[model samples]
Target: MQSAELQGILPGKLIHMLNLMRFNFNVRFISVLSLVN
Candidate 1:
């Protein structure tokens, strides 16, 4: 496998991971806000 091929694949994987983290963070933020109110 070439470095070029690996580079092409890594960003898609990283983006997927980031999206999942953002979703979980948003859920926690909303729950915290509700508790404070």
Candidate 2:
């Protein structure tokens, strides 16, 4: 496959991974914030 094709797929996969990480982190943060409030 071409480099461009790999790059195109990479961002989607990276974004999904990032979103999952963000979701987990956000949930933890929200819970902590609620406790502190």
Candidate 3:
């Protein structure tokens, strides 16, 4: 029962983490671009 619940929740957690990483990357990229200009 706990394994089943973990299976359901893991993917959502992974996607949320991926989204946070992407957002941080975007912010860094924009900052670098502004500094160059």
Candidate 4:
């Protein structure tokens, strides 16, 4: 939900792409962490 909001506010420029990429990376990281726990 929060990630989706961030994506909406961000532009499609290079920096925004990086932001979205980082957001995706964080989501994946959290999912993996939860599975590990």
TM-scores, in order shown? 0.72, 0.61, 0.84, 0.66
- Tell me the number of clashing residue pairs for each predicted model: 0, 0, 0, 0
Q: Please state the error at residue 24 of candidate 1 in Å.
A: 0.7
State the lDDT of candidate 4 residue by residue for 1-37, as single tens digits: 9998778766556677898999999999999999999
lDDT of 2 by residue, 1-37 (tens): 6999999999999999999999999999999999999
Off by over 4 Å in 3: none
Q: Cα lDDT for residue 10, model 3? A: 100
lDDT of 1 by residue, 1-37 (tens): 6999999999999999999999999999999999999
lDDT tens per residue, model 3, 1-37: 9999999999999999999999999999999999999
Question: lDDT of all predictions, in order shown?
Answer: 0.98, 0.98, 0.99, 0.87
RMSD to true structure for each model, in Å: 1.5, 1.9, 0.8, 10.7
